[model samples]
Target: MKNGKSPGSDNIPVEIVKVGRHRVIELLRIAFNKCLEEQTIPEIWNCAIVILLHKKEGTGEKAGSDHVRKTNEWLRHQSKVTDVIKRVARLKWEWVGHMARKTDTWSKRLLEWRPWGEKRPRGRPQMRWDDDIRQIAGTRWLQVAQSRDEWRSLKEAYTQVVETG
Candidate 1:
């Protein structure tokens, strides 16, 4: 539910959902539960809007005799799409660093704090938000994040590690 993303087929913006807040969350939860019980999602969920940009010159006019051929050619000529997973990982890593450096924000506190008396009901420990940060920057990642230059240097390696593993 990140902001500024394009609306889906429903054309409902994220801002509208944010305005609804808890009421929206509760409604969504109920709807999702009902969908799970019925084993069917809304038909609107299957719809998508795919807009093909006219990347080359002398294109984008109304369809004509050569439209299909030109569209196929343009599609074939396009390079591979950028890796979304790597981009998201890099962004998350950067955000973690930013939150880590903030002195007294609740975000920073929650990022570092573990519950005092929480009991685990699992064999293996669950993965955490900062697990990748710890993997790249070691146990002192928070301290390292305090230095912007040092944190920035780790971004490439972090993305690579995330991409591969």
Candidate 2:
């Protein structure tokens, strides 16, 4: 974008990410940037509240502001975004921050967490790997690893440990 000239019209750049998610990420990025530019946290917070309300719909009017206000009023003792329950994956503070408020609530938290699968502990941050687990995750490598498992064989456990060592 810095340089105006393209190689040619036919040279369309490949999209680095899936279109649907890429659009969402771009929307989020813009929202976060705007929030930062304007310095409004509550604006972002209100947007998230609206999203949460939409995510969880109840019997009737609870789907909208009547019950929402009741819930919000009861929940007003909170100061930060992370205080709310996070069962809903769509409850994205980063998007709210970017689009409405202009600041990321969990900027530090996002940077700190690594992509571990589903179950994450409440507080503790994950280490890169406990040992050299990454050293052999490839298909060919897994076969070697499986065969190397001494636990599979009924032969002397003591002998296997020494051999592995």
Candidate 3:
């Protein structure tokens, strides 16, 4: 085949027509390795890492969230990096500390920010953290917060729970 897809399709995502698969896998392997090597779990995973590789972007790749979910699920069962997983978990604690620092700064800024506004928005801004999210804010997490204070509080409370448990 001249390309991975049949020649008949008129519209093709450019990434599919251009980049090679082995290269893409190699990059993920690199990220995985770097994450392990640094003893850090990246705060961000580049959208381009997998988003650009979507079949919608490339004919050869899968586009649905299920595809990504299945991939991660497979990775979970694989025994290739059990030790690395533990190290990553330990790194998560450090990330919690970083999050606390960021949130404390945010809380301070928001306190100052209030002076700039005549009145805060009524009802809710949709970013407020409640009790349950705070409960899992640490070692075992469920959801994430957009603002730093909510994240810090959640992590702190969650950390207590993990320590007690």
- Most accurate candidate by TM-score: 1
lDDT of 1 at 83: 47
Whichever of 1 and 2 has more TM-score, that candidate is: 1
Global lDDT scores for all candidate models: 0.77, 0.36, 0.48
**Which 10-residue window in model 1 sums to the lowest lDDT?**
73-82
The 10-residue segment of model 3 with minimum total lDDT is: 46-55
For 4-86, candidate 3 gives per-residue lDDT tens digits of: 55433335454564566556556666777777787577655432233243433334345633433346436645523334544
Each candidate structure's count of clashing pairs: 0, 7, 0
Over 39-65, each residue of candidate 2 has an lDDT whose tens digit, in order, gives 555443554322243434453564444
RMSD of every candidate to native, in Å, equals 14.9, 22.8, 12.4
| Cα lDDT tens digits for candidate 1, 1-165 | 679998876788998989987677667666765665565889876787877765554454665433434443353234222345676788888898889999888988898788889898869998976787799999999999999999999999999999888
lDDT ranking from best candidate downward: 1, 3, 2
Clashing pairs in 3: none
Model 2 gets an lDDT of 0.36
